[model samples]
Target: MAAYAVSIAKEDNMSTSDITKMLEAHADRLPTESGTTSFTLTDLGDNRYRITGSRATSKHFSRILGMNSPTLSSSAEIAKGGTPAPCVLATNTSPSNGRGIEMNNNARMTISGCSVQSNATGSSSVHLTQAFITVTDGSGPGKLCHGGGVYQANGNAVSATKELCATVTDPLAASLPTPTPTGTTYGNPGTDYSWYGSKTFQPGIYSSGFVANNGRTHYLEAGTYYITGGNFEAQSGAKIIANGPITIIVMNGGTIRITDYSASANSFQAPQTGPYAGILMWRVNNGSCPNPITFAGGAGFTYDGVLYFPGCLLDVSNNAHISTRSEFTYVLADRIMMVGGSRMTIDVDNPYGLAANLGGGGSGGSFALVK
Candidate 1:
């Protein structure tokens, strides 16, 4: 009957033909059990649930479904150049729960260093609060994910040995790319207006929001810089240059920080290919964090790409070292502050996989488990 009822919510880049078009749009307001295609449950929230189907005339899509596969989400074994490409995320919507990768500068929250390259694990990516989150600093390299939870404080431990994953699939927040772009809308360069003697900027849609007046030397002529009311800031400077596929989209408000603490001669670079190739800076999540965005990268900084900007509260301070040398970097925010000695590296292979295939974390259809 209409694929055994409908109402398959749980969105966020949903796929599988959008659940067979929502079970062809309801089976008499039924709502449970789907057989024509064999049961297909999906919730994946704290309680968790995601039972795909294949061979069966009907065993259960209702009755609370099922979760017998040695415990649905089981993962452990990834640390040597294998599954480590959500880039660098801390997408915790901020109710404050260990702060994902938030460090107070005691040092040791290196999710991938700038130089001493060796440890590059962090498979599930790293999220916190609800579940599946961690940070380590005992031996580095995520300590090969001991998965027992031990985020030592007092010394600011990120990994005395951390790793408790079962599915944090946020493969780039639904294939990202929506900074609101229509046509031409730029304004508000007030306050004695002076972008450091105009270096060169020709993008679009500013809408009463365009103020970058720090020790400047700007040059962004690539495309897309849709900044809303919140006057963008790249202060703490002596330089803030952009010479590539550029993109900087902030939303409703003001004083939204992007990069500062003087990355020295900041040299931004994204769009290595097209369609905003990894991404350069996107802070448009109007859920909260009124205006908390202070991202700094030091030592003559050279931004490579991808700084997603989830909900709010993203401040990676001081000697912030992001994207190190870029092999295609990424950084999701919504509560990420590895204060002072912040070292958030990038380069686990993104040759533009861009979420592998897409449908929420790419690689199409993905989930498979059979014995």
Candidate 2:
């Protein structure tokens, strides 16, 4: 067997084609005899190489060559799927302590489905420098040191699965307190009531009120309505529909129930334009307890503006239907509790959909941290 050395240096300014030529030149130096020799190529300093190879030793020379002879076992067979003997082995051993492998500016790298275990440290188990790194399926058990599994430094970027194996420690903002409104009390009505612009109703509690008149409209200004102690219900036969946005404050220890009027009329709609055209809520303070803002009937309600509930109780019934059909978005209470027999639905087509939906609806619930 014979040896060959290949070198690639910074001074050479070698291109991909040049590297290919170097590799082929080294390959040409090997002996033509079938499996007579094996070669090992190690990178020396300055991108140079040291190649070494030898022929199988004869019985008499085995001892001098430190070669071991095996017994003649004719039945012995090579294991299937085993790594075949390599005619040559190439090792990248650039001297800057593995710094050569580090990417320079304007370089990028991506890795996927790789297990990074102990006794490993690098910018990343797979380092990508100055480039966009997209990691998918990076889940499962893996370990790393500094940036466990991956360390993205300045000019380096990384993205992994949501279920990354790294520990994240940060304080979450507390949920907004439930609102406490002041005024009169109103309950579910067998018939509906309509309201028009500039209609002044005394500040009080009202609930379980129905909208029996379809064309009838109601307008409420920026006033406080305490829904602390009453059942504010909207059922099938009595739809509590609104074309504009209304602000309601739920007091602590108060329970507000906005439910469906009927199975067929289970929806809420908001106007296509204008301010005060959406459904919104505000919490005055942290309630006596963390109560969710709940919607209990089998009907639906839609609002045009965003539904903002900093804190309150939200519950949806299983047999009920709740849909958002406006361009506005709806938000869930900071904390939500789910009871069986509740349904909540949101329209995907609407840009301003509900932040979260609980109960039997397809959209699940989520709690946003309050600052």
Candidate 3:
């Protein structure tokens, strides 16, 4: 599955060069609202192209994604719109192999203006936590959750209401693929760097590795990207635009470290079908090195897929957000942490649907009512 160059666009005035400049500049740090509406790409030779519109916005908020010493700041928050969905799914048995959220023993957490709120009825904001779910506020309710109304999970003695359910369980970790892609067979095999400028990427497996943000913008064609034997990193001033549903799979000792803070605002979504359906980023379970998945600083990092890192720590901070567009979104990890005004929101208007449709055992799950 080697990656090839792909160009898809409906507008003509926007030339390849102009697109390149826009991507490189990232104009307003994020694709302008109008720029993202009908985003497209103009072919520019080799494996390169330019952004066509404003990057869509998506953030993730589960009852609880996963936890091992998870930390949340007073500025942190977890919220969703439409229908109803749990803010954090704590227990692994809740659903989607406990895909919503989980915090095993030894996992610690800190919190502040953080809360789990929803608009829909019946659904609570939290699932369960093996570790203590602390609230940072000293005066007001120590903790908050939206279960139709604002429910106090933890608060000062007199104002305190319910307690977070503590059901400890060592949920099953995500199993590694039996037949992993052999970097040799799949996608385009090439070293197309977008860390300094603008470039486009086609679908397929990127066996070698991928890096962005030496100060540039990378445009990813609508398809699946398999990163093998290397790491996928995006730093300051790096931007990624997806023309359609996309999937990034990290395998063969490859890890994912995306720090699109302040400068780079990467916007990406995962495919809705196939083995990696609904998965925005899939970090291989490296038995030895528990490399963490760091997604921080991208105030406008829109993702509508599940970030499945069963054996790694998933840390999202610095005002990052994960939201759903057309489908549902979930985060499954060994441990999870969200701080610095980070948030996760789901839209029941377009929910993930039944658990069975979410694919595999731990791919995704439905939200359950918390007592």
How many clashing residue pairs appear in each of the predictions shown?
A: 13, 59, 47
Please give the TM-score that candidate 1 achieves against the real structure.
0.31
lDDT per residue, candidate 2, 234-317, as tens digits? 433443433333555554444455554443542333333322234354444443335545555444444433344433334444
Whole-model lDDT values for every prediction: 0.47, 0.34, 0.45
TM-score of each: 0.31, 0.34, 0.49
RMSD of 2: 26.2
Please give, for residues 248-347, the per-residue lDDT of candidate 1 as tens digits: 7777654456565454455576665656576777776666667677766553365666667776666666665654345455565654555556555543
Candidate 3: where are CA atoms >4 Å away?
Answer: 1-179, 182-196, 261-266, 349-371
**Candidate 3 residue-wise lDDT, 226-309, digit = tens:** 787677877765666787877787887777776764332455767666666666777766573356677667645656666666
**TM-score for predicted model 2 compared with the true structure:** 0.34
RMSD values, in order shown: 15.7, 26.2, 21.2
Model 1 lDDT on a 0 to 1 scale: 0.47
Which one is best on lDDT?
1
Name the weakest run of 10 consecutive residues (lDDT summed) in model 2.
82-91
Which stretches of candidate 1 lie above 4 Å from their native place?
A: 1-84, 89-154, 159-223, 226-232, 235-246, 249-274, 277-305, 308-315, 318-329, 332-337, 340-366
The TM-score leader among the candidates is 3
